[model samples]
Target: MNLKQFWQNFGEAAVYYPQLAQKMGGVSAAILYQILGRWLNQSSTVQCSLKEITDATGLSEAEQKLAREELKARSVLEFKLMRSQPEIYSYTLNFEQLEQLILNDSAVEKTSTVKRDPYFPPRRQPIAVSVTPHYQFSGPWRSQQQLEAFQDALLSYAKQQGYSNPGGWVFKIIDGISKGIKSPFWDEFIAEKPLGSSQKIQQEWEIEPGVPYPAFESERIQYYTHKGEPLESAVAKARSELRNPVKAKDLWEGFLRKCDRIANDALKAKKAGVETPYLPPSFSEQSTVTKASVMEKLSQLQGDSSLLEAENPPEKTLSEEEETSSDIPSLESLNNLYQSPITQNWVEEQIAKHPEWGYTIREGKVIDQYPF
Candidate 1:
């Protein structure tokens, strides 16, 4: 057998059907195909023994048999067993059938938009629901009455922390504690405040000496007025600075620096006669832009007369054109047409078309052929 010829055939087959190795029983079948091609000699048929195939492909006897069965089932190979030795078979590669199957599979794959491997199961999507901070516990409380009571007490504790709605995080914390998931926060919270207790918990958990809870809305407004900063920016900066405990003096200093920069910018803009873009916090408190303003802006941008007309349209009345369109084939004209002999003949012809209707014309008058 010519090794070069065998390799050439193998490469050609691989190029023609790139997925063949995987689709047709994997590596062992691919190796066997190449070995058979080497012994093919200018003919489609190759005479090979089971031992020869096993030796060439390094597949066990069982694997070799399975590969042959898969190749035949795929219409890529056919073989005839010899009468003398069933183990030795005359094999023929159905090149035409193999090529056809490959083309058909390719066409099918191209038509499918969502490509997924047939070998593996599809993955499931995660369940998602909107959770709000202010949501109260509404429970059936059948077997979980204790959990519900604990949740109510947790909500009361959260309210003392200035959170109107303690949010989903509180529930997650409580759930973790109930499930025996250990955490320092859970340990301290539970130890300091027992379940169903309305009394204030002791201040065992202390904030650092000079650290303060973040600034309130009133303080944020005061900072915005003094600093000439955007109220949003001032609020965001204060929240960021006080997110974790820092020295109270340090937090105040950061706030002051931000205010100084903003105030200087405002002064510079005023000196240059450039109007400051930042609005006062009071202006921000006003109601949002009305729908009419939005519509006016859209009309201006689109430059559409129809949109403007639609916004403040006049009372509608039927125009001459609409009135003329409505007078389609007057009733008197339709009655005259119905009295004509041509109309009668056309109607009779239509009835004659359906023999199943059992209608017959006798002396120029129609009647049902079959009557119950």
Candidate 2:
């Protein structure tokens, strides 16, 4: 790549390291770009000694050392020595890999904090009722006298069991019954009476997050928050510092640097006949190639026969009038002319606007303008 292209690509790579950009400033960033870019251009891969980097940058010996250390600290480049000479060092960072690394790191940091208030707010009572309604009797008919007798038996049972309130007594009784015993064992035991053993019942219930217990009173409830929410929301909410959020940017950059490391390692692994440590990044055709460019490529490779074959009938030729009247369109024409349900309404509207054409609807269908 030319110096301009190198800078652009290098800039893409440097995006993985936010702190490095800040540390190097614009001028130093340009220099680092030259140093790394030159190394990549000279060798099939980038791996260089200190002197080679200096030679590439045209910086002094002292300046070369400083640059090496700075790049290493910022993880812009990694160092390796094939021989003792300063220029004998070999290794380079892949900018694309680094960019993805930064993205992943930022993703991780953002997804890791708790943000919601734990305290429960007061519950609003229904305005029309003026009182909390209880579950009314909805079962088979029972006379008022039968209901009164049942209530008395329940109340006496509660007093015998030393439960101060009916709610507590009912709670225990229901708990025992649900646990598979026909009688309330806790009440009988508390009352100093012995009853036959009952089978142990195991009931499994799943509590949905934030749902209050039906049998329990009070507004307070326990709930589980998604683990990723706390850090993710916190990182998003925190304001940028130093004209931008340097820490977040740095993490992102560091991630990119790691990506570069992975990419470079992959190249080395290919050379060494070892497996690459990571799968490299991929882009969709829509993302990397424009529609115009794609069409241009297809046009260059096109043949008249191939084009003819793509049409509905491969073997037939059109008559002069048929060819002249042919409304068949190219891919581009199809894309441009694509219409949806909304377009139907729009066309009807236009026809309605023209006084010469009277459009009417019969039932659900348009009554006029049938061309086919």
Candidate 3:
């Protein structure tokens, strides 16, 4: 049904004349004002019936009573009971008081801005194309336990998305660590089996009746009210989110696990006297890199004289600043090979790309808070 077709004209300023509905209390009072305002045709007073108000604004009779009490307390309106008519009431509005309220609020806003130097109003976040924002960790600056948690969470989330072995999904993340994790076959894998479609809505619309779906509620309001989406479409979107609440954190952990696995492998190969301890970053067909090539080249593996033909790396003196094979590879040594200055710049780039981590990186220098 087109609810807008039956819309009535009213004072727009009433909703936020003094402050927002949330700041003032609830939207009940503001909604009450709109209903009464529509009936006042060049008159301050209007006879309003509770039944009529309830029919116009979906507000119950008890809600209307509380709204009237709030409006009277704010001095924006005064209502009197009509004799012999329990459902009817006469409302008298104060236009001067409402105008004064708006003027005072505007003055406060201007003064606050002037007092606060270097003030920047909050920027509206860019709309996400996906229902949920995905988080990825290409570097292993975190603990092994944390990495395992990320892997488990990622696999669980991918399962929810109906993907079998979501390692390809994790591997496609824009970093050189794709070959490190469960993504040796990533190039041909996800291309063949893409992520599955979202789950269907419940045939019975009773997704735990009486309990409000919090994540779905936020999405529903944005879609239905702000984006002007149809009620049916909004309901479907909300239900989908309610079922699949999180995706980013899962991906974040999974990729981190892969990086850690790669780092551990490199450390083991280094200790085993392997000539080429590290895998080449690229895994494309043109790239002359294979897991078998590196595994065969391992000097610790005996009986392969052909693989032994590979030349050893030149011996280099270790500086105090340089880490040995015994030492766990720092963020700089593994994924990021640059020094502090360049590494710090990369941190800023990551923050910009993943605005979802904005809260965690706010307190200190972005790199400081990061495990790196």
Give me the runs in candidate 1 sitting further than 4 Å from their true place: 1-18, 114-372
Clashes counted in candidate 1 amount to: 1
lDDT of 2 by residue, 320-364 (tens): 436644433243322222233423443345335543333444454
TM-score per candidate, chains pooled:
0.26, 0.21, 0.26
Cα lDDT tens digits, model 1, 199-279, are: 323221124322332233345456655798786777666555444444434655665676677678778878889776563
lDDT of 3 by residue, 201-289 (tens): 33221255323334324434455555777767876665554444354234335545665787789899988998777753321123345
What residue pairs are clashing in model 1?
Answer: 133-167
Cand. 1 TM to true fold:
0.26
Per-candidate clashes, comma-separated: 1, 18, 2
In order, candidate lDDTs are 0.60, 0.46, 0.55
In Å, residue 139's CA in model 3 sits off its true spot by 89
lDDT of 3: 0.55
Alpha-carbon lDDT of model 1: 0.60
